[model samples]
Every structure is written in C-alpha cells, then in structure tokens.
Target: MPVGEEVREAWRADLDPKIQAVRRLARRYGARLLAADGMFAALSATARPEHWSADGVHLTPAGHAALAAAWLRLVA
Candidate 1:
C-alpha cells in the first residue's frame, strides 16, 4: 500500500478506537470532549497542507489557530 493508505489504515486501526473510547468515557463522566479528532478529520478532508507539519504528526500554526477556534466554540 501507498504511504497515504498506510496512514489512513493506521488511523482507522489505532487512533479511531482511542477516540471512541475517550468519547465514551467523557460521556460517562459528563465531561466536555473536545472532539478534536472529528475536527481534524474534516480539516484533513479539505487537503490543506498548511494545517499540518512536514512530519504529518504535528500541527502547524494554522492548525493551532483552528484548534483554538474549536475550543472557543466549545466553551462559548
């Protein structure tokens, strides 16, 4: 498989289950889950290279701004 497909497969196999578990635990505790995974997935679908670092594991400044915006929206 290509590198992109590998990454997507890893996300589905690894990160997705962790996100689901956290969402479930947050609901059980009545805590506010940030839902960053869904937001990042949506942003990734837009194919915005600037939002991600060259390593593809970290966020760029634009990505941080977007995260802050999401947090504000959640708290507001």
Candidate 2:
C-alpha cells in the first residue's frame, strides 16, 4: 500500500531532504549507506493497509518483516 497523501507530503517536505543529507554525508565519509526507500516503496506497492499501523505512519508486523527481508538482502 502506498503511503497516505498526507504522509507522502510530509516525507517529501521533511524526511526526504533529511535522508538525502544523510546520504550525502555517508558519501562524504566514505561510509556504506543502505538506501531503504526503494525497498520500502516496492513493498508498499504490494502491501495492504494492514501492513501499516492505524496511523499509517508506522509499520505493522508484516511491514517490519518486509523491511527485515530487504535489510537482509542488502547485507547479504
């Protein structure tokens, strides 16, 4: 499930810039940056509302599992 409109707005306005800054810093420091946004987007494309919490800002159990799977793939 894609994020709610309001959440998407907030992400674009607030979180996205912060995430980008973090990525830039990681690059500057020659540190590994695990970019999870794409993974989350992919999951959201396939997931249901139940995958997220009621507030739609947090992950539910299934969402966490999906994220873990993505993280494992990145690490492996």
Candidate 3:
C-alpha cells in the first residue's frame, strides 16, 4: 500500500536535516557524498513513476539501477 502524505511529510521533516548534516560533514572532511537524495529527487521529477515502489518509500528494480548508475558516476 502507498504511504500517506502525512507520514511522508513527517519522514522528510525528520530526515532532511540529517541528510544535510551528513552532506555538510562529508564536505568538511573532504569525503565524497553520494547525493542519493538529490539523485532520487531528480529521477522522480523526470522519470516515470514505475521507478518507485507501491509504498513510495522504497525503489523498484529500475530505481535501484538508476541509483547504482548515479553512484558509479560519482565514484568512477
């Protein structure tokens, strides 16, 4: 089942700050941050809805592949 908008919003409110903190710390430490959230957001904006799972919290197979590709681009 799909998650409710309220739950989704709550999760974002809780997690977004932590993600930003990690990104900031990674930059401070001269470490590479994968920017997975950004990648996912971009994909969600441009790609078809099938990339995400029914619950909207997890990724489907294509989404995982896309994330892997993004990671490869950052690492390679």
Candidate 4:
C-alpha cells in the first residue's frame, strides 16, 4: 500500500496540473472531462482486497464494476 501511495503522490504531482489545465479549457469551451484517474483514487481510498489484481495496478472484475458504476454516477 505504501508503494501505491508513493505512486499516487508522483502521479498527482505530474497529473494534477495537467488536469487543472484541462479543467480550465473545459470551462472555457463548455466541454466536459471525465477524469477516471480521480475516480480511481476515490475508489482506492475505500478499496477492498478484491478490488485489485495481483499486480495491484490493474483492477479485478469487482473493481472494474465499481469503477463503471462510479462513471455512471458521474455522467448520469
């Protein structure tokens, strides 16, 4: 989990600015951005062991289902 946390820290450091830029552009253009990364981060916060595969990075079936549900909630 520590490794996952480290990776998330690095990922946010690199991506948060880019996501912010995209958010600005989306706001300007009246467009939408579906940020799956943020969705996954939220899921990971409450993740069960079955949520991840052996590799940890990849999602298991249950995880994929959960993510899909989250996406639907965002879009719906």
TM-score of each candidate? 0.77, 0.69, 0.84, 0.56
Query: Of 1 and 3, which scores higher on TM-score?
Result: 3
| Top-lDDT structure, candidate number | 3
Local accuracy of candidate 4 as per-residue lDDT tens digits, 7-73: 7588679888998999899899988667766666576678754364434567778767876787788
Which ten residues in a row are the worst by lDDT in model 3?
A: 48-57
* lDDT: the better of candidates 1 and 3: 3
| Residue 14 lDDT in candidate 2 | 84
Model 1 RMSD, rounded to 1 decimal: 3.0
The top-ranked prediction according to TM-score is 3
Q: Scored by Cα lDDT, where does model 1 land? A: 0.76
- Write down the RMSD of candidate 4 (Cα, Å): 3.4
lDDT by residue for model 1 (45-65), tens = 886654544445677787788
Off by over 4 Å in 2: 1-4, 49-54
Model 1 CA deviation exceeding 4 Å by range: 1-3, 47-50
Enumerate residue pairs that collide in model 3.
none
Evaluated against the true structure, the overall lDDT of model 4 is: 0.70
